[model samples]
Target: MMPQTTEMADKLDVLDRGSDGEQRSQPDVTAQSSKVSPLDVLKTDLPAGLVVFLVALPLCLGIALASGAPLFSGLIAGIVGGLVIPLISRAPLSVSGPAAGLAAIVFTGISALGSFSVFALAVVIAGVMQLVLGVLRAGGIAHYFPSSVIKGMLTAIGVLLILKQLPHAIGLDVEEFGAMSFQVGKENTFSLIARALEVIQPGAAIISVGCVALLVFWDKVPALKKLTWLPGPLVAVLGGTLANELFQRNYQTVALQSEHLVRLPSTDGAGGLLGALHLPDWSAITRADVWTLAVTLAVVASLETLLNLEAVDRIDPWRRKSPPNREMLAQGMGNLTSGLLGGLPITSVVVRSSAGVNAGGRTKAVALFHGLFLMLAVLFMAPLLTRIPLACLAAILLTTGYKLAKPKLFSDMYRLGWSQFTPFMVTVLAIVLTDLLKGVAIGLAVGLAFVLRESMSRVYEVSREGQLVTIRLNKEAFFFSRGKLVSLFEELPRDTHVILDAEAAPFVDHDVADAIRDFQSSAGLRNIQVEVRGLKLAPVAPG
Candidate 1:
């Protein structure tokens, strides 16, 4: 949802200029009027849709793995997000899909609840909540969530992703019987790391390491650098496929088995495409945890959608703004459809939406086409998709995790000072130790405390130079600040001259006025000189 636009104008400027670097007017998209044909739109949006499909394909697979969900769930989310949202949403260029950020939440939710079906029900509930939010026109709700707390949620998820994917990377995802029965979160994340190291699969480890290296240096390769239409993930998957083929041909002993690769159920069976249905358990709805999970999903997904929509607008070449309530309603329907059809929770993903824009997609057709591509892939490409090794997917997630919680993010938060840093750090630690909802609650309380302190602190300014002191009232001073006022006078040095300046203040509470008057009258006890500038105390009540 965090759509990045740093230096985007410079990158997009070349597209607006001619070969000679002379500027030209932007195309009048409506010049052709309503007469624009489907074929023309397909021609314009198809290639861009293909680009988005390539970009979204591997991510869907990888995010499903990261979330401990059936791989088809990811594709289902992609299809619904792509196909459904664009039909109703005013955000023409925003691409909705399964998000990397939600992986941690899904994994923990399933583990705590001990059932994917139950989790699916939670997703359905979340969709309903989003629909209600839309109906209430609560599009402005995103403004209420503190950015520091949100950043903390994401940073913790990054840490969780790295921890969660490590075992998969090393081919040590041996689930103990009933492990999901009591599993919760990163409390055991490191323990899994230790276990993965003990029984590492050489083939998977080698492939994963190589894939990570390739991703790290992908743009450095001269030929690959120019292939802007080709996504790095697709390249990594292709490389892994080729490497597996080489192993199959020559290294029989270490060739990765079927268990190490993607396990998409074949579409040619008696059930055909419908055979992959992993429907929700309706009985789980009565559980309190399920309700809690639903609320969390609804809130998080809504925030992500709103933020990504805003981000997409900033980078849109056409400079269009999306209607937030309509987008929310669209997301609600998308998630509702996805949940009913055995899919992961869906959100408007910044990465895919921004990628669509970068790939020259300017209309809703691109999103629709991308969804159709996902649906088709599941119907026909299951055989080829099953050959993709888990290690390569692991590498994709590792890169994603690294980017989400980069080292620079840490230093940047610290530089924002304690007001921002305290909540961010607290949220990170709490989420890592606990679950998403609990941690965010703790962080929000801390953030709100800081906000309250700041509000109070803003009412006055205190400065002292040697023996001279100044108390500057800013706009207003109330009863809550009387303790602060009294405390300030108590700190006076002997024979100090004090100036209580109220020129800027239009209203001073009677409590504050009384406190100032009492302080002024008693200053002679400490040989302190008290002068009130442009100030009048309230009339004292007769005793």
Candidate 2:
């Protein structure tokens, strides 16, 4: 391959094979070496971890609030997810925590369970179920999804990040933080955009625009590219926060309020952190409702985690393949620990992982250090971190989203022909309009339909030699394929000898056999001769 083509091929491989990705995350959610150098951890992963931590902190709090759980629960899950899942998951870049996708589920689960502690018990049991799924090798299901659908899912996530965060960027729209589903309360994604336009904050808009501008040019400039360790997001958030302070001091009217900043429950004093945690109510285990919710949580969390895991691995810079089973195991442990520690249920978050990748993360320490940061934040830095404006963070995500759903990706998909492009776009639209899992299902169905049609076409091949026309059966020709085959048989030249062969077919549907027999019986009327091979239908009598 030529240099440019080779590079493009490598990028597609990264997008398809669970390796080499250039950039945002997906529900706004790779493979790589199982090993890392200590220096790499210190110089690369740690900085990326800080960047991810900055991204994750607000999300943790926001998701918990959206889920109607204690605000502290989101932080707990983030800390546990950051610290635990990385230790066990083979996916080096994935960062785990309270996810926006699960907020509605958690909300309903909590209402059904009657108490947060009871819901915590269900989360623990859900973890056990995930462990069982891992042991059963359920993660193998990851391989079945078509590459087009997967890419669509990733792209759809990018679109979601942009739509969901656009209002946040402008520091308007009335939805709670991390409430990013297509529908939230009374507002849908698009309606929120209209709302944002109606209520813009000048300071918040400035911060978002500045941060986005910085991110766009940060790597393009030679001077900025040299400081890879200094992630653009870290600077954006810190600077935005400082700018917010200056706004308050010098220009009060346009300054962002507390609602536009990171919101964490204070964890100061001697035992405030410990005081905030709520232990699971083990006594609730006997209720069928608890088990029911547990099963639901397990299935949902595992599915989301698996999908996110696949997406991350597909884009890993090192092109390393992560073990899906190990990811399940890690998620199980993470959820289990979170439930015990008074946290909401946990999953690998696409947004945080993608942000880390976009920021140049290279090791598992990205997760570990982020988790550690969460812990430190809870112990110490809540007030300072809270100073950071959501608009700046939104800018970072908007930049990431632009990378994932670039115009080039769509055009490239279109060039792959309908077989690929159809499903890819379907998946993207379904995901953007609906939720992640539903969108994937809709896309998978379309892709499979194409596969089935293609398979039917491959069931038989036709060839002609002089007066003989041979139709050779392949695979197992199904009843649904008989119509096409019979039509082809009818189109054969009237005076030619036609041979029906089934040597390659393992099984022929009865409908297909009858069609062949009917053709043989009538061929003489058209001066056509029929010969049968391998097919066991009795020879037709003279007409």
TM-scores for candidates 1 onward, in order: 0.68, 0.87
Model 1, total clashes = 0
Candidate 2 residue-wise lDDT, 493-539, digit = tens: 87998888898899999999989999888888999998888989965
Among the numbered candidates, top lDDT falls to 2
Model 1 misplaced regions, further than 4 Å: 1-75, 90-128, 145-159, 174-187, 266-323, 339-344, 349-370, 412-424, 427-458, 462-470, 475-483, 489-543
Q: Backbone clashes in each candidate structure, one number apiece?
A: 0, 10
Give the range of the ten consecutive residues with the poorest summed lDDT in model 2: 24-33
Per-residue lDDT tens digits for candidate 1, residues 1-543, read 223254543444444532112344443444113344565566456766775776577678767877899877888899998888899888878899998668778989999989888899999999999999999998976557687887776676566556667777888655321121113344376677788899898888888888878877874575764454555655777888788878889997667888888665456743565777778789988999999999999999887788667656644666667889998999999888888988999988755765565445667777998998888877777777768777776776666566556677787789999999999999888877665556777998999889878867888888989888998999678777788778878987889999999999999988889998888777899999988998976544554
lDDT of 2: 0.84
Best by TM-score: 2
What lDDT score goes with residue 29 in model 2? 8
Worst 10 residues of 1 by lDDT: 175-184
